[model samples]
Target: MARAPSSIVVFIRQNPRTRQKPNNQIRSLTFENKEGDCGNEETKPNPHREPSQNAQNEFTEIAKEVSKITRTKPRWEQTLLSDFPSFNFSDHRFLNEVMKHQNNVLLSLRFFHWLCSHRGFSPDSLSLNALFDALVEAKACIAAKDFLDYTGLKPEAASLECYIRCLCEDGLVEEALGVFDRLRGVGVCPSIATWNSALSAFLKVGRTDLVWKLYVEMMESGVFTKVDVETFGYLIQAFCDDDQVLKGYELLRQVLEDGLDPGNAAFNRLISGFCKERKYTKVSELLHTMIAKNRAPDIFTYQEVINGLCKKRKSLEGFRVFNDLKDRGYAPDRVMYTTMIHGLCKMGLLGNARKLWFEMIQKGYIPNEYTYNALIYGFCKIGNLEEARKLYKEMCDRGYGETTVSYNTMIAGLCSKGRTDEAHKLFAEMPCKGGVRDVITYNTLIRGFCKEGKIVESTNLLNELLVQGLQPSTSSFTPIIKKLCQVGDIEEAKKLWNDMQSRGLTPMVYTQEHIITGLYEQGYVEEGMEWLLEMLKHKLKPREDTFKRLVHRLLQRDQSDDSLLVLDFMLKIGYTLEKGIYASLWLLNFAKRIPDLPKHD
Candidate 1:
């Protein structure tokens, strides 16, 4: 016990916070060690001895190794809410992204909500302008309204601008005006975009008067910092489209007055407008202007000019334009050639059209479907059915498949020339020859049958259509009914009308009137009057001729009282009775040799 191990004391001093008291615990450990170390006791290692300082160093080294193995800087981190304080909506790049990708309405709304919530922006914050823009790009008007209502957001000028644009794009001009009124009530003056949108809408729906008023209003607002090309361009287009080429010229003057040169698109629109109005002199003046301005004409400009000249029956002038286009190193495409062909054909120069067709082929420019159709139609129009058929066969042989137009031309040609057998044969062979018969085809064939006094055959064809699962339209029934009435097949015509009604197809006014006329012509005056009254009951007024014919037919049968009754009914229903009606009724009453006149009720 004299010299206790110094290591134990060192360990106790190092772990001095241990619960063992240093004095008693050290003394008891020393006494036990001395007793165990008696001469007869074997020397034993001290199991309770504290670890050496080297062991603590090794533990520290392992922890450093562990940290080195597992730790590194992260690549990315979550962005905090306070990052971007101001976001622009009209930024072009951002707009492109919104348009190109964020097209869904719900996703846009959710993104807007996240933006509003995270940015802590007020409901009226300008930062939310992009969200409104996104709604427009997505065409989500209902969502936009919901967003405004849910956020208690008052309409800002930008919001109004977006709403007006969306509404105008959807052709809801009246609704757009209501939004403009709302903007004015809110004291939010519209921006250029908003004014332009309203102007465009007015012009689109042919409200030129309103467009001019808006233009004056916009000029007076003193808000336009600059007049853009698009502003004048749209105005010029509106003027030209509305058939006011002179006014369009005035607008061009205004553009020049404002120190702006009209661009090609603007000039083209003016030229096109003049061309459409057949004002070739003005078109020429504009073309010279374009040349003086060094604005090279594109294909569309040339087409317009050529087509304009052609429409005026100036094929030689059109050919001059065509040659001019060719000499300018611009290859004459199908449209240019088609214009020439159409012009030539219209001028009764089908031979030239055929010549141009051959030239087109020689130049390795294959005639398009429209070109072939035009030639065939031109031939048919001049009663050259044989040539039309020959052309049709050539078109087929050249691997140019026939369209509904091709068949229609051939069938209509044959029908016009009273070649019903051949027309019917071609019509029947249409589907088998890889051609699908559309409504026009059926209408053409039906009309052909009716024209040939084959009412029963035409009716059978109509039935065949129904059996083949094809639905005939109002147009389909109209001509057939008219022809049937023309042939005095009133009973069958009425049956067809009933069939139409049963199939949920309402006969057009013309169709019904035709049947009524047919009834009158067939000496069914009472039935005609009854049907006319039925038409009036259903709010379908008969035309002037239909009423007069029915009344005259009734009177012809000495039914003056019935005629007067129908006439009174016509007048009571706000229809003006023609003077001929009363004269006819008076003459018929005078001519009648009735022994006893029927007393009025």
Candidate 2:
């Protein structure tokens, strides 16, 4: 008979295996033919053929088992092409996995391209949806739209929802509405999820009218899915934001009527909004209602009430609330204590605020930046700069960075104490990280320089302010002019007045009066008269006392004609020139040998 075809065939090269152990060894034996003349069938049973075929079958079985084990393992562990087999182009889960690990959308796109090119798969709805979600989450709406257009994928409700959410989050509510319309055009009915999402978007941006309309539409459509908690919470928030607290309460009542229990977050938001509006009585009632409903105030609720009371200057009431919170076993955390302390300090109750501060420390609450700042400001307000400085140093030693308020307080305190040099030193040493110095800092330093009789230095500071792109307030210029007048620097005072006018800082009536008085005091009678005329041109009446002093001084200096002119001007201006006019006329007669001074205008 012809030799049988080889039973074993090698499709692929076999992997090498280690030698077998003694327990795994195979035994071989030879058998003699019991019946003679059995021809080829009796031949030794073709040991090589049987062994080889059996070994080949065993290898095939083992290979299949290994493949099954690998296939059952997690997708992440498998080799890319070997186990991936085919790309699930429509699976958003894969895209989400791509996005979750790889933040780059472009990289994700390239990955999809590679999958299509190498795996011979085209992009499907699920893949497009995944890309859309990834882009929405990443806030790349425009890119997502471009990709969808490129892939020619129709907009599904899920994809539209994602796009609409992204648009709303980006404050493009109009665009979101357009997308919703497009979704409707596609014949996809809006689910409750869709309406709720749109309604929430409207609520977030204070579009209450639109929210109500949407709610009505949703109800009339008879597609009643459960209204999400977020929908109710945002609606309440919108009402509160619009100062419609009563309306919000009414809505909450409606929620209950609808058999939906308002969640804690909704209650908290409503109460916080009421407190913000200073509707304290309403807030109290809401608190009671929450309690009656077995919903205790959360930390945020307690903090909100405390903050509101403090803001309204009802510190005593705030303290009571604090005590009530503590009695109810809700420990006042650091923020609560800080809020109370700050409020008390603002009310000038420094002693009480300090006591609370100590109590907070004793209660194991570490003082934070706000606590220290409040204490510093309180001490400063009470004129206890020494204590404020001590606390400031303590803050520095503890490595807390000096905030702008902290630096400003110290600078202002030093200036108030007439310690300009120390103030300047501290200001110069201020760390640059707190951003550029504000206008208040510049104003304070300039005013301090003026107070110290350092007019040039003050002017230089003003110049520095200009160089630094800062505009000086009217008050910033007032002190310098006042300082010049106080020191009898008439010429410099006049220059400053001109400078102020040039800079469009219209001199107030009081400021012009100061300049006139300064000129007169410095014996610049002619200049003083000019300023008085300017004041009159601006429709400002000079004080009677100032006019009397000017006239008397002019007459004493033998300037009788000038004195008479001022008296005539005073009469023209409707000033009551009784004693002042008589005194001036008397002085004029004595100076110029005239019997009476001309007073008729």
Candidate 3:
């Protein structure tokens, strides 16, 4: 007997050892299958008999020849017909021989095409299935689609459904929809499972619009005359993705009224949506309902609830839920532990956060970057830079590379504690230490420099910020503007103000107030009055002290007309003049006979 080729032996060995049949026996079975047109000893082989030696030799010769042809060139079609003119195209043995090179589906498909064109061959159901199996196995979705259309072969409905599912599973959703539409146009309704698979593919890719469209088409086309539980589940997901969670909730109610279990996925999605919307009450109600219905919420379900409570500044409630899950014997994963730790840190419950941190480590969950940054931010918020620094060092030692957030929090903490020099040192080290400085980094350093009255350093940083191509926000400009005004450099302050405007950054009341006060203090009373009027024109009320200071500065300069303008502006905004300012204004009015200020009603 001729030995099988090395490729064939290798292919046989790759099969599971649990198969009781030996390699020879498996290869024998392939020849026993039906051969449609090629002349054979019998159409049906005897079930009790083994393949004869001659049949084995012929199949081996075919495998060897096909392997040689596949290796030589792309134009194997002519060589294949010349080599195996009497080969059985419909035989499973031939398919198994050709599919040994299944890794190259193009070769297998071309061989199949050559068989059809030159040998006048037509594949049976089993042969077609083998082709589809190879195509799907290789994830050659586009090629499979073209082959199906080119041949105009109408595979059985089940085969088509399976192909649709394979198409969707491989993320070729648009191609899958084309197959689905073809099936529908031919008056074939795919199974509900296939429909759900298609629906899920759309949902996974966030094409909620297509999900709804297909669902409506599914209903209108009478594919599913009655919607099932899975259909309703997909509909709920679509509504949630569309941000219409309320409508999804109503549909869930309808599903419940009809006594169909909408399943755990439906419940989980609704919980996630409610969490994002901060609807903790609805989340709790659904959690209890899931438990009551014996559709017990999973880890993700509880995580959503805990995350929601934490976001609404309700960490206390979140902790309670976390404990409840623990009491139920569910071990929280690192992500869940991190969420609780973050919530605790945000609420300044450092004692609890520290306990959870140790507990997480003890429980064999390593802290990630988010976990360390959360605790670090909390420590920074409370002015406990030492603890934050220790945690940061540990985080670095543990190989959780220092993040921009960690650096920013530490820098801000140092600056807050009047350690501007240390903060600047760290800021300067960031780029060298593999840290990318963002706009927030420059803003923090600029504010720190302004706090120390280092006008030169602050301005240098502001210039560096622009050179770095970072857009400065209102925080970046406000402090520097105030500092410049305090130093009587009102011209630079005005320049920064205009620059801020040019950047389309709106000045908040703090920035406006500083500019207004700076103008008056630097003896630009008219410009100050004009700025104040600009604010008033926009219905922005300056601080009462700022308004009074402007009036005082104007009066001291003997600018009675400007003071009258100030009084008129203040009265228009419904401010009650101070007793001192009222008296001063009254004396001014008597001296100059300026128009009387309007009396408050």
Per-residue lDDT of candidate 3, residues 1-601 (tens digit)? 2222344334333531211212221233255433333236432223334445565555656666685576455455555555556555555456655555333555556566656664434565555656655565555566667667666667767767878888888888887888888888888888888999999998998888779778877887786667689888988989999999999999998888888899988998899899889887788788888888888898988888888778888899999999989999999998988899889988989899889989999999989988898888889878898888998999999897767887898888888877899999989888888888988988898898899999899899989999988878999888899999898888899899999999999999878888889888878888888888888888887877887899899888877788878878778778878888878867876877666689998
Return whichever of 2 and 3 wins on TM-score.
Answer: 3
Best by TM-score: 3
Cα lDDT tens digits for candidate 1, 428-538: 888888888877788788888888788778878877877778878876677777887888777777777887888898788889889888878888777777788889889
In terms of TM-score, how similar is model 3 to the real structure? 0.63
Flag clash pairs in model 1. none
Number of clashing pairs, model 3?
0
Model 2, 111-162: lDDT tens digits are: 4544555433455465565565655665655556565655777766776887
Clashing pairs in 2: 90-126, 90-127
RMSD of each: 21.4, 16.5, 9.4
Highest lDDT model number? 3
